[model samples]
Target: MDLAARSPAYEGLAIELAVEDEGWHDAGLGDLEAFARRFVEAAARRAGVPDDVETELSVTLTGDAAVQALNAEWRNKDRPTNVLSFPIRQLQPGERPGPLLGDLVLARETVEREAAAEDKRFADHAGHLLVHGMLHLLGHDHIDDETADAMEALEIEALADLGIADPYADAPEHL
Candidate 1:
């Protein structure tokens, strides 16, 4: 993946983006990289990070098997998830050096499956996952009702900017 163009928020940040493809065999690599970068930019803006914040991040697009293993190892879940974020560490006070935000791993198969099940476009779902992962990189979580609501609202707004409809608006009744 090529990351020649970066988000304005990462202008002065000594950031290195490494994109890895694990044989997903669906979408083109360029599209995936662009989508990942867009997600990072949106998330950075939402987190109130200045364009000059020195941050480094990486993204990996993998198949279900790889993600399933990761989910099992890290999250203790047997099944593959749409996305997983691994943040490195938080910077302490007066730590003026750049921070490594860590990696985002996305499952191509899971993303497609969820998109189909939710009656949404695959690209839109992928975009949402990217944004979701980026938020995680920024230390956001939705383990509770209130946090979930706020996170979902932010996701909706972010998706809207990409001309996507609210993903949770027409959730299945059973859910």
Candidate 2:
């Protein structure tokens, strides 16, 4: 697709997608922009963001190699992950942010493999990850048990809005 094929804006946030992997073309995931907006709005609402939260969230669809390189460079992990969220800046309480909401990088291969292994539809898993990533961009984290619980619950709520089942409901041990 070319520049003219860019998706329309959702709510006050503009979703820009960059598909770098050929495999993504045939992934059967439909209307990614709409999905991103749906989850993002839900996440922002859960985060207490106002209805007029204007921002641009760039969603890059790439492969495991790209994600692994980023993981290694930024998180010091030499492994491929499903998604990475890079928030542009941290906003203080009662503070407004700039137009950019940072970026979300997704590994198509890793996400596909995980969905298959977990007996989930790829789109559903992607929704979960997308919400998780957006939450991260909104300054949510899972660094500790308490924080993890809150974040996971928020993820579950967002997924529910997308009509996806609770991801952790069927999660295997050691996840």
Candidate 2 residues lying further than 4 Å off, grouped into runs, are 1-10, 91-96, 172-175
- What is candidate 1's CA lDDT for residue 80? 85
- Candidate 1, after superposition: displacement of residue 28 in Å? 5.5
Model 2 lDDT vs. the true structure?
Answer: 0.81
lDDT of 2 by residue, 1-175 (tens): 7757755434577789898887887888767666667777777776666666678889998999999999999999999999999989975423454699889999999999999999999988887888888888888887788878888888888778768898999786312
Best by TM-score: 2
Candidate 1: regions farther than 4 A off:
1-7, 12-25, 28-30, 90-98, 172-175
Q: What is the TM-score of each candidate against the true structure?
A: 0.80, 0.86
Cα lDDT computed for each candidate against the true fold: 0.71, 0.81
Looking at model 2, report the run of 10 residues with the lowest lDDT sum. 89-98
Clashes of each: 2, 0
